[model samples]
Target: MGIVLNQSLKNTVITYLGFGIGAINTLYLYPVFLGATYYAVTNYILSAANVIMPLFAIGMQNTLVKFYSQCKTEEERGRFLSFTVLFPFLLCIPIGIIGLFFFDDLVYFVSKKNPVVQTFIWLIPFTGLCMAYFEIFYAWARVHMHSVFGNFIKEVGLRLFSLFAIVGVYFNWISIVDFVYVTSGIYFLALIVTMLYAFKIKRPNFQFYIPANVKDILEYTFYIILSGSVANLLLDGDKLMLNQYLVIENIAYYSVATYIALVISVPSRAMHQIVYPITAKLMHENKYEELNALYKKTSINLQIVGGFVMLCIFVNISQLYEIVPKEYSGGIIVVFMIGLSKYFDLILGNNNAIIFNSKYYRTVLFLGLFLVLITIVLNRIFIPLYGIMGCAFATLLSITLYSLAKLLFVVKRMHLYPFTKETVTSLIVTAVLFLAFYFWEFPLYPLIGIALKSIILTAVYLYVNYKLVISKEINDIIDKMLLKFKLRS
Candidate 1:
């Protein structure tokens, strides 16, 4: 635990810093500098690229992590690394040729509702290609037991670069169109830097031989590619569908609101980094009792924390929208719906980790595919009717249904559930706080009003949770903090 904590702490800080920069860029800089039209264009291109990235990489990044340590000798290791780097060419070559031949048709298809996308269609695949290889190289560094540098490049480095690029646009050094190109080129730059760092860690031997376990490798890679696509689709597919059904500017509105809702998941994301390995170990040791306790603990704890974030955001969403452009404020409902979905997912803490480690992992793949299919169908049905709000509703429905499915599957398979009486209490507390504060605003500026309301809400919320002892783990944390303060005094 100590070693893992020490190693991961810096990376975690770097990741949060990146998210901070991204939030600023999404909330203020992009909308202010580029305006709605170009912001929509850039976001659409990136979202489309992300959705297709799994296809481009063919799952080589994860494959490298899973199989790298299996090599008994340098020769085998070199061959495996070489294969991971080169395998994507098998898909890239054909895709490139197809793109070359049918470029206009492809552009026309995607840009039917949003013709602004036509000129930038090529950047989608190019950016996806850069993202794919960058991950492969990052994985290369990880396999050599040097992950911090790569993580920095992926998290902080890219965002900082974008911060500079946006600043460049502000200074009239680059056109909005040029900013898009520059952003895509940043991925290429990240790839080259990561590749160089990987080489510095342990220079590649560039062996041209197939690994002896090529059969198993290919099988695993095939499974991963399909499974990986499910996540990317769930994350970005709505934006892509919006491009087809609605005007592009709506995508920018959706993106801004979605970013606000995304903050609700931060606690869950951070906890998972620490909990994943422990969950895996418990499963390996067949400690069913402890695993079940952990399942419930994580669920309740995350519900409490994430629910707080959701409440704050939901209550202050109007103020937040005030900080952004007027056109972006129409996504108020988008924020609520998306935030609700994320809150539901938050309460199912460690459910994903358990499923990924269990024997029924493959079964969940089919379930995930089912989820992706349902998401697409819902988006197609709803986006035409609701526009950005419709897309948010589709997302909310698909994710809630998918989360319920996962919960039931885990309960049925392992006889482990993440719910307890405390879970219900946590929900009630969250609801009460939200109802109490939602209409209570300070007659002040947006920032000051938000701060005052949030501080009052946090005080009341924590007091109630402490008095009721909603979670033993949380109570202990509070006790520790208080004890330290008393000692210092």
Candidate 2:
């Protein structure tokens, strides 16, 4: 718990800092600097990049993480690392060749409905290539057990670059076309810097050698590539599909709301870095008692933390939207819908880590593809009818369904549940707080009103949760933070 807590705290702070910078860019700067259409284009490009990279990289990042520790020597590790660095080229070259032959068809498909996407459509793969390499190098660093610097580069450095670029736009020093190109270049810059650092941490000893377990590695990477693609599609396919059916500006509207909602999942994401390995260790040891305890604690603690975020966002959603451009303000529904989905996924704890680490992970191949299929089907069916709200609905539905299946699988196989008495308490308290504060708004400016409501919400929420002990772990964390503050003072 000590190591987990320390790293989780550091990650939480860094993640929030990144999100803070992103919030500035998404909610404030992009809205003002790029406006609705260009802003939508920016987000669209990135979302597409995320979806495309898994295919290009062929899941080498996850493969690296899985097999790197199994090696018994530096030579074995070096060969494995070298293979991960080089294997992606096999798939990448094919993708490039295909894109070359089908460029017009690809461009036509993307921009047939929304022509703005046509101009920067090719940037998607370029950005995807850069992002894929960034993750590869980031994994390179992580294999050396050095993730903090890479996390900073991923979470904070990239956003900081975007921030400066936005100011360039605001000052008319950067045209929209140039901005798009430079933004893609920023992703490549992150890849270059992170790759350099990865080498600095532990340089990959280049060998024109493939590991003996090339078959196993390829098998795992293939499964991972498909599963990873499905996951990313569920996350970003809405934006991609929206480009086909709706106006490009709608992506901007949806992106802002989705970004705000994404804040709810930060706690779960922060904890995942350390928790995944711990879960794997416990499972390997067949220690059900400890694993169950950790599962319940993480679920309840995430619930308490994620619920607080959801409460603040929902309670002050109206005021939050007030600060955004009026043209983009219609996505309030998207926020709640997507926010709830992310919250549900969070409260399931590390269900994913448990499943992925277990022998039953093969089931994910079927389940993952099903989820992706349904997501795309739903988006295709609904987006034209309900527009951005439809996309939100699709996301919420698919994610909740996916979470439920994971929960059921873990319980049926492992005979443990993530819920305890604290789960009920945390949920009840969250519901009450949301209902109580949602309709009660201050009669003042939006920003001030949001501040006032948030402060009140946090105080009362904390007091009640602490009294009920819905999550002693979170309370312990708060206590430690306060103690450190006092000691420093």
Candidate 3:
């Protein structure tokens, strides 16, 4: 528990720091300097790359994690690692060939209004290839319980590189077209760094052998590919769809709103990095009791952290939009809708890790596919009528439905629930705190109003949570931090 707490705290710090830097890039620099159309191009291209990259990897990244724990010897693990490295390339060639032959058609179908998109269409395959290898290499590090470095490379390193690319574009050092290619190059560089470190830690030998267990590996990979692709679609498919149905500038507005809303998930993402492997190990040992306890604690912690983030965004959204162009202010509803959806997800806790690591994973994947189809249908129906707001509402509905299904599935199959008396208490306290701030009007200055409201919110929420004991883990962390500082003094 101590180790898990420490790792979660460390990862949370790094994750939020990365998000802080990324928020500047997305919220401030991109919209203020690049304008909406160029920003849309950047967002669309990246979203396209994310959606296509999973297909190129062919699920090897996930396969590596699942199989690494089951291997009986170092030799078997080495072969598994080697297979992960080689498999993505095999998948990439076919994708690249198809993308090359049908490049114009693809652009025409996706974004005919935005001719700039045609110039950068070639980057899709290149970026997808880089993303595929980066995930594979990062999974190699994750299997060995060295997640911090990979987290840095994936979250911070890539963002920092993109920051430089954005700066280059700002200074006219490069065209936006070159900036797109350079962003892809950064992913490849990060992949190489991950590979070097993975080798340094556990040098995988390239002696390929046909193990009897290879069949199981392939089977698991097949299932996970569907699961992974569906999950990717749920997260990234909307932007791609919007690119097709709407103007490119609208895509930029939606992307900015989505990014701001997504900041709430930083804690959930950070915790999952530590949770998945640990949950896998516990499941392997049949430690169901411990697993259930961890699940409840994780749910409470995520809710508390994620709730605060959502509150801050909801309260300060007006000020946040002030930092961007006035046209982007129309995305305020999109921010609230997506933020609510992510908040629901946070409260559900480690449901994803538990379900994915369980034997009931296939059922979960089926549910995911069903929800993806629902999301697509809703987006098609809504985007035509409501535009970006419709997309936001569709996302909110689809995600909430998907989360509920998973929650019910876990309860029925595992005889466990993430909710408790404390969870309800936390909700009540958060509501009261929000209402208190809602009624009190600060001055009209956006920055000052935001800062003042944030302070009041944080102080009141902490005081209420302390009195109510909303989370034992959070209480313990506060105590530990205070004690460490006292001791140092």
Best-to-worst ranking by lDDT: 1, 2, 3
Winning model by TM-score: 1
TM-score of 3: 0.90
lDDT of 2 by residue, 1-489 (tens): 575466567767888899899888889888888888888898899999999989888899989998999999988988888888887877688879989999999989999988888888889989998999899989998778777788898899999999999888878898877788889999999999999999998866788677888899889988998888987888788899999899899999999999999989877777787799899999999999999999998899888888998999999999898888888878999999999999999998888899988888988768988998889899999998999999999999988998899899889888989999888878889998888999879989998999999999999998899778788887787778879889533
Write candidate 1's Cα lDDT for 64-87 as tens digits.
Answer: 999999999887888888999887
Q: TM-scores for all candidates?
A: 0.98, 0.94, 0.90
Mind sharing the TM-score for model 1? 0.98
Model 1: clashing residue pairs? none
- Clashes per prediction? 0, 0, 0
- Candidate 2, residue 399: the lDDT equals 88
**What is the alpha-carbon lDDT for the whole of candidate 2?**
0.88
Candidate 1, lDDT over the whole model: 0.90
Q: Candidate 2: where is the Cα deviation over 4 Å?
A: 1-9, 475-489
> What lDDT does each candidate get?
0.90, 0.88, 0.83
Which residues of candidate 1, in runs, are more than 4 Å off? 1-3, 487-489
